[model samples]
Target: MSKMIFINLPVTDLDASTRFYKALGASRNPQFSNENAACMMLCDTIGVMILTHGYYRTFTSRTIADARATSQMLLALTVEARADVDRLVGAGVTAGGRADPNPPQDHGFMWSRSVEDPDGHVWEIFWMDPAAAAGDTTGVDA
Candidate 1:
């Protein structure tokens, strides 16, 4: 069987977070959702578990850091094209998320945009042409 990845994130408001993710094209997995937690299916192999701050604390003894003030990690997802990256970012922003404070990246072969969800979770949406990214200097500057 293929390995599946589950990312757990603490959210200040479960309902709002659920809406934000749905706007980005993820669907809620009823099998794993509840009053205190929601399972957002990003795809067949990846799932994001959004837990209420109180419920999240049950898993760890440490205090939850305010994501707005500090970034613990950047969650990245690769899409088929640059447009797809932009689309997700647009959806996120429209749903009350904020774009990354940093400038977008464009390396000829790869393009990326970042956005912060309502709870301040950072997500990087990117796209890369495999051939161009593999050192194929055809039509690209070295």
Candidate 2:
């Protein structure tokens, strides 16, 4: 069986967060969702679990950092094409997210942009040429 990754996040508004993710192309998994939490599947093997602040605290004793005011962590998602990276960021902004919390990056071989969710979590969307990724920079510009 293939390994799966589930990133758990603390959200102020579960419903809003769920909707935001949905707009960004994630499907909600009803099997593991409820009022206190939601399971948003980014893909077949990757999921994002949106948990209410109260429920999230149950899992850890540490205080939850306010993502908007502090730098917690940066999450990144790689898509198949450069257009897909823009599409995801645009959708996120349309769904109430903040666009380009970080500057967009374009290095000929790779392209990336960032969007901040309603709860202030930033997600970097990127795409890289397969050839460049494989170390074949023969035709890459920079």
Candidate 3:
């Protein structure tokens, strides 16, 4: 297994991406950050690299997705409670993100809401209830 979880995101401007992610409660890891790209730490080990399109292309042979006009990443963040899921999704929307075209889904064991970041990256905030899951026999993944 790897020690790091790297999510390479294509951004038109690195600084803007850094600021946008900061608004969503992420801190820039200075040890792995510069003007062209920066590691936005999501957790102790997970990070999303906000790399400039040109700089990121070196890692792949294909063209970068124009995230401003289309989708590229679909990230799911699971919380401990349903209210937390909704609150986090709402916070993202308040910070210039967009909510998905669906309502909060209650899957007996879990509830979820999806949002899109300012750069069109999809994020699903979910909450699982173990007690509800134990009671329901057919609870499926949300």
TM-scores for all candidates: the values are: 0.94, 0.96, 0.78
Query: Which has the greatest lDDT?
Result: 2
Ranking by lDDT: 2, 1, 3
User: Candidate 2 residues 65-116, lDDT tens each?
Assistant: 9999998799999999899999999999988899999999999899999999
Clashes of each: 0, 0, 0
| Better model by TM-score: candidate 1 vs candidate 3 | 1
After superposing candidate 3 on the true structure, give the runs of residues whose Cα lies further than 4 Å from its correct spot: 67-73, 101-103, 132-142
Give one digit per residue, the lDDT tens place, for model 1 in 13-120. 999999999988889999999999999999998999999999999999998988889978989989888899889899999888998655799887889999899888
- Minimal lDDT window, size 10, model 1: 133-142
What shift in Å separates residue 26 of candidate 1 from its native position after superposition? 1.0
lDDT of 3 at 4: 74
Per-model CA lDDT versus the true structure: 0.90, 0.95, 0.75
Higher-TM-score candidate among 2 and 3?
Answer: 2
